[model samples]
Target chain A: MKARVTVSLKPGVLDPQGRAILHALEGLGFSGVTDVRVGKLIELELAEGTPLETVEEMGRRLLANTVIENFRVEPA
Target chain B: MKSGVVVFPGSNCDRDLMVALELVTGTRPVALWHAEAEVPAGLDLIALPGGFSHGDYLRSGAIAARAPVMRAVADHAGRGGLVLGICNGFQVLTEAGLLPGALMRNAGLDFICRDVALEVVTTDSAFTRGYRPGETITVPVAHHDGNFQADAETLDRLEQQGQVAFRYAGEVNGSARRIAGILNDRRNVLGLMPHPERCVEEAHGNLDGRRLFAGLVSVLA
Candidate 1:
């Protein structure tokens, strides 16, 4: 089984990289870009019987810093 | 006092921390690798030096925080051992849950590298004992992500407990409350974005940072 984690900065947290990307998009003449919040998508290859709780623990322990970021796990 | 400096793969300031420790304590600090599961016994302090650990992959200090050595550092702190984290080390300490708050990218989105004026906010902690409260000193801060942020409640508690050790005297980063350094709830651990080790000697242009290490000696003695 594969687990995919999408990590994003929490609401109200500043995203400097995302802002830079948004600016770059505007510079490229792209329109209708309201906002951009950068995030990371990490794909994990887990053992067949690995529980969701285990994966969530991984997210809490190392994958995402709960202080400023949030993460969700998706089955793939 | 016996001290140790945790060295991750990309850590560049381990030697500098070791030198600082040697100069202040008159003893060489052990260089513990990130792969190690335990710090050596009988350590008075554990210093996490600055660098782009794990090349800042995933996130700044994110990967290195999960390294084996950090587990030991956390345990050591739990046992009341003094832990001092600087620059990227501050990021790692926050990631490891040893300190409160997160270091976001600078509000200006620039990699700031220069001497920044900092005011001593709390002189009661072991880390800031040598400096008088409200005294301003210049220390070099070199980092892209040093803006500290925390929830309002935590910030209030930190202030009430006098855990805010140092604050930027002027606008340097977009840190909440202008916090440049902070002490943990237990007050034995300190995490700061500035490079005190770099400014320890007068020949290095200023010795303003020396009192921090000197204070540590007095506290731990």
Candidate 2:
């Protein structure tokens, strides 16, 4: 089994990289793009039937900085 | 002062910080590797030097924060011992939950590297005791992720408590309130983006950063 963690800057936290990407899209003539938020996707190989709590713990401890980022785990 | 400098695998400034510590304290600091589960005993200060620690893989300082040595670092701070985290060290401190807020990518999407003016926000902490409040000094910063952000209420508390130790004389990284440095609520731990260790000698064209080391050494040693 594998666990995939999606980490993103918490809402209302400034995402400058996302904003820059958005600006580049607009410059490239992409229209109607209201927003862009950049984040990370981390995949981990875990034993089959591993509990979500364990992966969540990874996010809480390392994968995401809870102060300004949020992370969610999904089965991969 | 009996100081120690934590050397993470990718830490490049450990030598610089160690040199500054030795020059100011008249003794070399212990070079504790990140793998060590314990810091040297009887250390007055533990300096986390700047670098691309753990290669800034998951996030700046993320992996390094979880290294075994940080367990010792956290213990040191909880005992009221002084800890100074510079640049990537700041990121590690925040990631380790020893400090509030996070340093994000630069707002302009550029790697900023240059001298910038900073104002001392408070002189009460062990880290800023050498400077008068509101005095400005120049220090060089080289980083990609130095933008500091936190919720509004946390910012208010830090300000009210004078935990904000330094702020940019002018905007440099789009940091909230232009914060260049901050002290932990205990006022013993400090984290900042600027490389004070780089500018600690007159040969570096400035003695402003020297005062910080000198003051801490005298008081804490």
Q: Tell me, by DockQ, which candidate is best.
A: 2
Q: Write the per-residue lDDT of candidate 2 for residues A13-55, one digit (tens) a residue.
A: 8888888889999999999999898998999999888999999
DockQ score, prediction 1: 0.70
Per-residue C-alpha lDDT of model 2 across residues B1-221, encoded as one tens digit per residue: 78999999899999999999899889899999999898779999999999999889988999999999999999999999999999999999988989998898888879999999999999998889999888999999999999999899989999999999989998898999898889999999999999999888878998888888988976977
Kindly report which residue stretches of model 2 are placed more than 4 angstroms away from their true locations once superposed: none
TM-scores of chain A, one for each prediction: 0.95, 0.95
DockQ-derived CAPRI band for the predicted complex in model 1: medium
Candidate 2 structure lDDT: 0.91
Candidate 1 clash pair list: none
Worst 10 residues of 2 chain B by lDDT: B212-221
Regions of model 1 farther than 4 Å from truth = A29-32
